[model samples]
Target: MTVFISPLIPVVIAVAALVIAVIKDYRIGTLIVVILAFTNVGGQQIFEAYHVFLLIIMLTAFSLTLAVLRGSVAVQGIKEFNILLAIFGTWSFLSGVIAIDHELWFGMIEYMIRAFLVLYLVYNSFSKGEEIFRLFKIIVFSMFLSSIISFFAMIGSLSLSVETLLSLFSTRFAGTIVDPNFYAMTIAGIIPLAFVLITEEKRIALKAFWIISVFFLMLTIVFSQSRTGIIAISIIFIYSLYNLMRKKRVEILFFIIPIIVILILIPPAFWFRMSVFVESLSSGARADTSVVHRLLLLRSALDVFLKNPIFGVGLGNFEAIAGRYTIDPMVCHNTYLEIASNLGLLGTVPFVLLLYRGFMLPKHSMQNPNVRELSWAVRTGLLGMYVAILFLSVPFKLDLWILLSIAAILGRKISSEKSP
Candidate 1:
């Protein structure tokens, strides 16, 4: 006889684990949620119709409420970053209110709210340098896990051969994120964090783990075949090389060797794609259909922005109305352009301010010895992410928000240290 098990059993166990984690330590609970947010494992269809990730977040939030009531967690008031976030969120809501597709707008709005909550929780939960470092490690760990999963997915048959490798390079690796470009962008953002961990780690085993993680992550990006991801990786590599040479020259070998191997192993098709991408930038005649399509989308976004200079089409309305301007209906693949065309200057201004604040946090914290490495790591990671987003319409990415929160918390911690 076959025993029938209810699907709710797993859900109940997961809920219990999340509650226990939060009760023991709310920061740990936040980290668990961050891992889910980054890896997107909890969002998968593990429970059929139920949203396991949302349930975890709700339970964690409830546990946090209890912690606050017991005075274990202290709530802080609004600051500059919070003010900018609130303004941007409010403007987005207004834009959504007038959106052409209310359902799409509401969906995006809900995602934005969730991202903001993550930022708020992370910014408030951790205060110490060590705690912040753990947060970074957790993010790097998430990426490492994603890279491994992607590697296996790329090597479907687990057969090691030039033909198999070359065939795999022709295909993009989306991993758990389900979008090749976004997955590669996410990996690019985490690469610098992994590198920093390698440099700061005292134990040889941990350092080796980070170095291996970086290797897998680089491989994942290469398999993704995203030009934007490659560009971001180049920027990160140059920055990391310079820093390693200055601080830990010996560790440079660990960093450079993997890159050299990757370069040598990358198929000609990969190089050809890069060449085409570069040539297309200078001459539209040489551009592939994908490049031409993006160019058209860019023009459409500009046209929409011009028409609605103050508050463009409306949140999530660009996708609804894009077919009228372009041959195909799609969201503008450019984040800044998407924002400008969707919400106009009213929304873009505050959004840009929030990003500026995130960037400045690391700049201000550079002097603090306690968080100097972390500051550099966060800044470099953000630099890569910012460059990647120029070609991606991902305004509600939870990982980006979490990184910003880390920067904010580090900045505040540095400020507190400097104060008498």
Candidate 2:
């Protein structure tokens, strides 16, 4: 006996939020984007009926448009990365047009367009330092909320009876995001942000809040049992440790002790699950089918790229074409390979350049102490995200775009300060 709330409830709430945001400031619209970025509308599918994200995006766009019309906005000039992204997007659409799988191409292109729009909106919504910090706080706080829910979900699943366990842990404690790997990667990206927040906070209570949030984030990622997520967090942790050792050696224990304590306190089940990674390391031994499966898909992606090295088989066509090579007929599972196979060398060049520019800006902008600390976190967190996505084919994820947008904003701010 499942009960349903009228879809109108969410609709009304979204409408009211949008209206208030419009009446307020474009910054409110920015806040809305940050809020929705950390939530999803589908799983068992109840929330899909409410179309929460779709409504939020549409309303945010409308609010921004209204604000612009009222002379409250000044459009910023596009940056180098924006140009590369636009070129990449055009190539994606052209490839989709010529794709052998018309239906899939159409659906994928439509979704990609919406994703770009979200990126554009979020990028344009903030032009000041305060707005960016506000957005960052919302993003970090949303991550904290997500981590708490996922921690509880994992605990609840652990307590379930054997007969009921299948239904619960199937999602592996994913809260709003459906896939455990996606959820874990999301939290891992936040780990660096949490570090930055903790370091910058002056109030003891606020510092404590970020400290607890970091704990939950670590616990959630470990509980997720995602190898990619764990690997990503390891990279971030090592980078943070290196920075602390260079600048604040005594403070290194603050991070190290908490992680050591968490590991000691975690249940034995966590160790058993983590052992899959160790087992898979032995050559010629397939401890997990997914490892071998990814290799097969990677090989197929290489074949496809070799066959169509110019423009690719076409965007969104890898699964359609690569299925012939793999037993399960799945995605390439590697973001770089997926781009190579789907968009080919032509599109791949600009796509790679986009990442290069996005990352380089933050690396160069570190001369500004304020921007350096924040930008470093975004840079390293995004690097971890890029590494994590190497094992998953989510090129159009909102967080990736949000991160790139943040980098671009930082670049713009830094450049503006340097100008006469």
Residues 348-405, candidate 2: write the lDDT tens digits. 8987887777777777567776656677777887888888888888777777777887
- Point out the worst 10-residue segment of candidate 2 by lDDT: 41-50
TM-score of 2: 0.87
Name the candidate that leads on lDDT: 1
Model 2, backbone clash pairs (residues 3+ apart or across chains), number: 0
Candidate 1: tens digits of C-alpha lDDT, residues 108-148: 78778778878877877887777777777888888787768
- Candidate 1 TM-score, true structure as reference: 0.90
Where model 1 places Cα greater than 4 Å from the true spot, the runs are 1-11, 42-50, 158-162, 242-255, 415-420
Could you tell me which residue pairs clash in candidate 1? Answer: none
lDDT of each: 0.79, 0.73
